[model samples]
Target: MEQYKRKIALTNARFYAYHGYYHEEQMLGNEFFLDIICFVSNPTLNTDDNLVKTINYEELYRIAKEEMAQPKKLLETVVDNILNSIKVNFHEVNEIEVSLRKSNPPFGGDAATAEVSLYWQSGT
Candidate 1:
């Protein structure tokens, strides 16, 4: 049997939001970069290209945007929320990968950006 797989991805989606552990970081806000990829199993090839048959990346962006707007103490929480929201709405997706990054993290000295990534699979 031949297996068909499709990947829908949104990369480097930037947002300025208040999500941090410290009060100062939350109050000041920071730039966040998000990357997400959705995997879909195509049991049968679609002769006709239908938007409904595939994941809508625009909708994914909206979900990420909405989730990022809500303040949280950790990037892990944000990543989990985004993953869960997608799973709930897009039941067709078999797997999901999300990475959230906070630029110019506090702690000084040409600091590196803080990042958290999550991978999810159906029924796991």
Candidate 2:
């Protein structure tokens, strides 16, 4: 038995997509960032050198990229969607988290960015 395994993550992934509440935001688009983490439990993590034995990071990035392309009004919604997508694809993961950030929101002021995050763990 290999016990538990290490986590896999894609951090600071940047995308320019039309996603926001205001009309201009949907039209003009803006910079968006994402961070996804998946904690996997696999018995072969230490023994097998095969990609199939553990979480494929490229597949994880693909899920986030696809979800980010869809325009949504709220970051929370986007985060939720990403989480669900990951859950659907990587059903064996022990824990997962997704975070989305919108850079320099239109409100002006000195606010750096608007961010939202969603997290999940197996068994309540």
Highest TM-score: give the candidate number. 1
Q: What is the Å distance of residue 99 in model 1 from its true position? A: 0.3
Per-residue lDDT over 21-97 for candidate 1, one digit per residue giving the tens place of the 0 to 100 score? 99998999999999999998863455698778788899999999999999999999999999999999999899999
Candidate 2 regions exceeding 4 Å error are: none
How well does each candidate superpose onto the true structure, as a TM-score?
0.93, 0.91
The local lDDT score (0 to 100) that residue 69 gets in candidate 1 is 92
lDDT of each: 0.93, 0.88
lDDT of 2 by residue, 4-114 (tens): 667989999999988899999999999998999998765455475788877888998898889889999999988999999888998778899899989989999475899
Where model 1 places Cα greater than 4 Å from the true spot, the runs are: 43-46
Model 2 vs. true fold: TM = 0.91
